[model samples]
Target: MADSSAPVLLGCDFSSSPSRRKPVVLALGRREGLRVQLTALECFDTLAAFGQWLAQPGDWVGGFDLPFGLPRELVQALGWPEDWLACMQHYRGLGRDQIRAQFAAFCRARPVGGKFAHRATDGPAGSSPSMKWVNPPVAYMLHAGVPLLLDAGAHLPGLHAGDARRVALEAYPGLLAREILARRSYKSDDRAKQTPDRLIARNDVVHALEMGQTRLGLRLKLSHAQRDALVQDASGDSLDAVLCLMQAAWAQQRHAEGDALYGLPQRFDGLEGWIVTA
Candidate 1:
C-alpha cells in the first residue's frame, strides 16, 4: 500500500565503527504490489558520510537496526536526567567501565529475577531487554546508536522528534531471521559461529524473503548477482539492510492505509517504534 510514487524505501544495517570496516549498508527500494524492488545497495565507511545521506531531503521510511531509547525504569532508578538528549550525553561521557560498573551496581541492588527493566514497546515488539549487554548487546547498541539519529535530526516513530515525511523505526533482524529458522542458529557476525551452515542459512533466509515468505507479505526482488553478492558478504551487512528495507516497505504500506505514523500499533506499551519509510 506504499505510495508507488514515493522515491524509495531506505533500510540500514548499522555498524558501531564505520571506519574500521563497512559500518553501514543501505538497501534502496520500494514496494510494488507484493514485491520490493531492489534498486541499490550501498555501504558507508563513516557515520559522517551516512549522516550526510540522512540529511539529504528525501521521502523515505527506514528501518534502522538500532535501539531507540532506554527503559523508563532504568532511567528513573539511575536518577539520570529525565531529558532524552541530556541523559544520553551523560551516558556518553561515561567510559565503558563506568557504564558497566553503574549497571552492575543497579543489578546487584535489584532482585535476581528482575535485573533488567522493560520498555513500553517491549511487549509489542517482543524485543530483548534494553539493558541486556551480551548476546544482542542491545543496551550498548542503543547507547551507541540513538544519539546518531538524534544528531542527524531523524524522526523516530514512537520515541523521538522528526518530520512525518521522513520516518525512522527500530528494527531487529534477529526477529525476522528467527521466524524461519527458529532454534537453528543461522548467522553470526562473531567469527566463531560463521560456519558454512550459517552462511547457507543466511542464504536461505534471503531466498525466503525473495520468495515472499516473510510475515510482511512482501517479496524482495533481487537480481541473481545481487543475491549472490549478499550471500557472499560474510559481514551480512547487505542482508541486514534488506531485512530493514522490507520492514520499511510494510510501514509505508500501512501509512498509505491512513496510519500517520505508519503501521506501528496504537498500543505500544513500552516498546519504541522502529522508523519506517514514508
Candidate 2:
C-alpha cells in the first residue's frame, strides 16, 4: 500500500469538449523517493464536471496536458496583450469563429514553411503549436482549459498566482512518449487506426516507463491491473495521462530540490508558457 500522507500528484489529458465517448482523463498518483506510483484514474465527461473537480480543495501538483499560453509572436502579431494574464482575458472574450478568422489571416500572410508562430519551448518539447485549431485543435483546448485553471485558483508557476497547495504546470506527454517511442504511433482515436502495431507500441511505452528508461529517471510503480489497463486502452488516453504523471513527478522532484519554477526554465517567455519537462 502507498503512504496515506504522501502529497498527491495529477496528470491530466484534457479536451476542449468532452463527452461520455471521449472524456478528459486524469491520472492521479504520488511520488515516493524516485518512484512514482499510480493511485487512481478519473474521467470527466463534461467540461463543467472537470472544472468542479479542479476547484475542489486539495493539496496537489498537477501536470496538465494543455498549452497554458500562446506563442509570443502570434500574440504580438494579433495585437493581443503582451502580459500573460491580460492576454488570456482578452482571448477568452473572442468567439471561436473570430479566433479562426484572425489566426487564418495571420497564417495566410506567412511563408509556407513558417506559417505557425511557435513558442520557445516548442523546439525542445516537439509539440503542436498551441494556436492550432484543426486536427488536435489545441487552440480550443487552451480557450477551454486556462479559464478553468484560473477559476479553480490553481497556481500556475511563472504564469498566474493562486493557491499554493494546488500548483498546475503545463505538460506535454508527447515529449516523454517520443523519447521512448521515437515517432512510432502508439494511439489513434479512430477505431480503424488502432492497429495491432499501435497496441505493441503502447505496451512498449509502459515497459520503458516501468524500467525508468526515459531521461526523467523515475520508475513508475503500478499494480498488475493498472499496468494492464494502461496498455489496453486503444485510444491511449490513460497512458498519455500517466506520461504526464511522470513529468509531474519530475517537477515534484525538482521542487523538493528547491526549484520554485517547477522544473521550467528560469527565463522563458511569460507570454508563451514552458512545458514542465522540456
Candidate 3:
C-alpha cells in the first residue's frame, strides 16, 4: 500500500451510455515504489454519475479510456475549430446524428482502404480513430466524456488545462494488453464469446503485470481476491481499467522525472490528442 498522503490515481473504462449492465468502471490505485497497489474498483451506473464524480475536488491524476480529441483530418474536413478546447466546445454543441453524418461524409471522400482519418499517434497506439461512431462508438464517447473533464476542471496533460493538481490523460489499454497477450482475444462483451482460452489469457496478462514484464516496468500488487477479480471479469472492463491505472502511474513517474508533458511527445498535435503509451 502507498502512504496515506499519496495522491489518488484513477483509471476509467468509459461508456457513452453507461447502464447497470455496462457501467463505467473506475479503478482506484496508487504507486508504491515499483508496485501499483489495487485498492478499489467502482462502477458508475450512469453518465451523469460519472460526471458528478469528476466534478468532486480531488488531488489526483487519471487515465481515461475515451478519446480526448477527434482526428485532425476529420475535424478540419468538418470545419470545426482548430484549437483543442474550441474544437471540443464545437463538438459538444452538435448532436450525435450531426456528428455521425459529418464523419460519414468525410469518410466517403477518402480512399476505400483508408476510410478513417488517423492521428499521428494512432499508428503506434493501435487505437480506433476518435471519430468512429460505431463498433466502439468512441466519437460519442468523446462527446460525452471530454466535456465532463472540462466541466470538472481536470487538466488534460497536452489537450486542456484545468485544475493543475488534477491531471487527465488519454490512455489505451490495448497498448499494454498487446504487449503480454499479443493477438489472443482476451475479452468480449458477448457472453458466448467469452471462452476459457480468453479467461486464461486474462490471467496470463495479470500475471505478467504483477511480475513487471512490460515496458512500463511497474508491478501490480493485488490481494489474492483482487487478483481473481481482475482475471475473472471476462468483459475485461476491470482489467482494462487496471491497465490504464498502470499507464497513469507511468505518466506520474515521467512527470516526477522532469518530463513536463507527462510522457506525451513534445511535438504532439494540439488538435489530435496523443495516447499516453503511444
Candidate 4:
C-alpha cells in the first residue's frame, strides 16, 4: 500500500487547445524511495476542465510539459516587462493573432536557423523554442498553461510564489525519452505514421524506465497491464505523462533532501524557468 502522507505526484502531457480527440493527459503516481509507481492516468478534454482539476484542494507536486516562462532575450527585445510575474501578466492580455504577428515580425528580422530566441533551459533540455508559433506551438502552451497554474495558487519555485502544498515545475519528456531511445522515434499523432518500429521503440523506453536505466537513477513501478498500456499507445501521450511523473519524483526526492528549489539549479534565470531535471 502507498503512504497515506505522501503528496500526489503528477506528470502532464498538455495540449494548448484540447478536444475529445486530443485531450490533455495526466499520469498520476506516488514515490517510495527510488521507485515511482504508476497509479492512474486521466484526460481532460478542455482547458477549463483541466483548470478546474488544478484548483481542487490537494497536496501535490507536478511536472507539466509546458514552458513556464518566455525567453529573456525575446521578452527584452520586444520591450515586455522584465519581472517574471509582470511579464506573464502582460502576455496574458494579448490575443493569439497579436502574439503570432509580433513573434513572426521578430523572426523575419533575423537569419534562418537562429531566428527564434530561446530560453536558457531549451538548449540543455533539448526543447523547442518557447516563442515558436508553429510546429509544436509551445508559445501558446505557455500562454494557456501558466495562467492556470497561477490561478490555482501553485508554487513555481524560481518564478511565482504561491501555495506550498502545490508545486509546479516545467518538464520535457523528450529529455528522458532521448536518454533511453537515442532519437529512435516512439510515437506520432498522425495515424498513418504509427508504424511497428515506433511500437518497438516505445517498448524499449518503457523497459528502460522500469529498469531505472536513465541517469536519474529512479525506477518506474508498473503492473503488467500498465506496462502494456504504455507500450501500446501510438500517440505516446500517456508515456510522455509517465516520463514527466518520473521527473516529478526526482524533484520530490530533492525536496526531501532539503533543496527548496526542487532540484532546479541555483543560478536559474527567473524569466526563462529551468527544466526540473535539466
Candidate 5:
C-alpha cells in the first residue's frame, strides 16, 4: 500500500484556446490507501495560465487528457525528425492553418479507409490521431499542450523530461468511462443536448467511482458540494477531470508498486505516448 498521505494528484481537461466558452478544467486530489479525495476543482482561461500553474512548486503525478506526441508512422511519412523532441519542436513552429493543410495534404494521396496514420497506442486508447485538427481538434490540443508541459519542466513519462516530482502522463477519461458506459454519451457541450439520460449516466459513473468498481480499485470521496458540482456540470468536464484524476491516482499506485512507467506498458512507443491505465 502507498503511504497514508500521497503527493497531490492532478487531472487536466485541456483546451487549446481555453476561454469562457471552454475553459480548461483541473481536478486536484490525494489518495490514501484505496480512497481518493476530491480536494478541489479549478478552471484556467488560457494555456499560458495553465502553464503558470504547472510551473508552481509541487509534487504530483497528473493525467493530462492530451496526446503527448505524434504517431511515429506519421512523423516518418512527413520526413520530420524521428526523434520525439525534435518532431515536437518542428510541430510547434507551425500555425494551425499550416498544420491543417499539411495534414490534409498528407491524407490527400492516401486511400479513403487509410487516410490517417495512427499511433500504435491509438487503437487501444481510442484516441484521435495527433495529426487530426478538426472535430475534436485533438491534434491542436497536443500542439498546444505538450510545449507548455515541456516549458514548465513537468516530466512526461516516455516522452519528455522535467520535474520528476511533477510528473505528467497522457490521460484519456473516455477510455476509462467507455469501459463502463460503452458508447453511451454521458456529456454534451450544448445545454440543449444535456438530456436527462446523460445525467443518469453521469450519476451512474459517479456511483461507480465511489463504489470502487473500476480496475483501479480506487474509491472517490467527494464532499456534498463537490459531488453536486460534478453531477451538475452537464458538459462533463468536471466528471472527465475526476476520471483523469482517478487515472493519476491509479498510476501513482502502480509506481509505488515499482512499475517504473507508472502502469504504462513496458514497451509503449516513446514517439506516441500511452494513455494512463489503457
Candidate 6:
C-alpha cells in the first residue's frame, strides 16, 4: 500500500501543443500540517513523455488543468465514436481543421441559447462551456488531454475507474486565482498583456498561497531555493501547477469527509455534478 500519511499532490499545467516552447509544467509536493510543500518542479516536452510519468506506480493525487471530457451534446450530434477511449482516439486522429469543421457543424445545428452541451463535470465547476474553441480552447483541450489519462490508466475520481495509486482530477487555476484576485488579470501567454504588473500579480498570488489565504486553507511551504525557482519561471507554468495542487489538496480533504466523488455543486439547476474536482 502507498503511504497514506504522505500522499503526494501533483499539479500540472498542460499544453495542448506539447513542445519545447510549450511543455508540460508539473509541481510535485505533499501537505505538511497547514502547508503544501514543494518537492519538485519539472517540465515534459511531449504528451508521450508526460504520459509515461503519469503511468509510473506511485501514490499521487493530481489536479491537471485540462478538460477531461467532451460535451455530451457534441458527442451525440457529431455521431462521433461512443466509447470514451475510442472517441478520444478517433478525435485525436483528425487534423485541427477537421475537428473544427465537425465542431462547427454541431454548433450550427444547436439552438442559440444552448450553444454548448455540457459534460457531467461542467455544471458543478462552472467551467468554461466545453464548446468554446478559443479563449481557453478547452474543447480542444479535451480532445488533446483525456486520452492520455485514460491510456495511462489513471483513476479519475467521480468519473472513471483505473489504478487507485494515481488519481487524476480536472482543475482550473483561473477559478482559484480569481477567487482571491477578482478581475485582476495576471500573466497571459499573450505578449500584449505580459506587463510587469501582471508578473507582480502572479508573484502576489504565489505569496498568498504561501500565506494560506485561499479557500483550500493550505499554505505553500517551499524552501528559499524552491521559492526562487518558482519566481524565476516567467511562463507561470510552475506556479499554475502549484495552484492546481492546492485544489487537489482541497478535494482530498473533501474525500476524507465521505464525498468520495468530489466536485463543485452545480448551479441551482438539477445538473448536480458537472465539475469533478477530484
Best TM-score among the predictions, by candidate number: 4
* Residue pairs in collision within model 5: none
**Cα lDDT tens digits for candidate 6, 5-116:** 7668889898887888779999888875566777888899988898888877778888889876676567767787656656667777887778778778777877898766
Query: Which lDDT value does model 2 have at 18?
Result: 93
Total residue pair clashes for candidate 2: 0
Q: Estimate each model's TM-score.
A: 0.86, 0.98, 0.98, 0.99, 0.97, 0.85
* Winner on lDDT (2 vs 4): 4
- Which pairs clash (backbone N, Cα, C closer than 3 Å) in model 6? 120-274, 121-274, 121-275, 122-274
What are the Cα lDDT values of the candidates? 0.75, 0.93, 0.91, 0.94, 0.89, 0.74
The true-versus-predicted C-alpha distance at residue 3 of model 2, in Å, is: 4.4
What tens digits encode model 1's per-residue C-alpha lDDT throughout 134-181? Answer: 666676767677667766677776555666677778777667776767
lDDT of 3 by residue, 1-278 (tens): 48767678889999999999999999999987788888999999898999899888778889999999888887777788899999999889999999999889888988889999988888999999888999989999999999999999998877787787889999999999999988998999999999999999999999999999999999989999999998899999999999999999999888878988989999899889899978
Give me the runs in candidate 1 sitting further than 4 Å from their true place: 1-4, 81-98, 123-126, 269-278
RMSD to truth, every model: 3.2, 0.9, 0.9, 0.7, 1.5, 3.6
Which candidate would rank higher by lDDT, 3 or 5?
3
RMSD of 6: 3.6
Which regions of candidate 5 deviate over 4 angstroms? 1-5
lDDT of 5 by residue, 1-278 (tens): 43545689999999998998789999999888789988899999988889999888878999999988887878888899988888889999999998899889999989989988888888888888878888789989998998998888888777776778889999999998987788899999998999999999998899899999988899999988999899889999999999999999999989989887899998888887788887
Per model, state how many residue pairs clash. 17, 0, 0, 0, 0, 4
lDDT of 4: 0.94
TM-score of 2: 0.98
Worst 10 residues of 4 by lDDT: 1-10
Clashing pairs for predicted structure model 2, backbone only: none
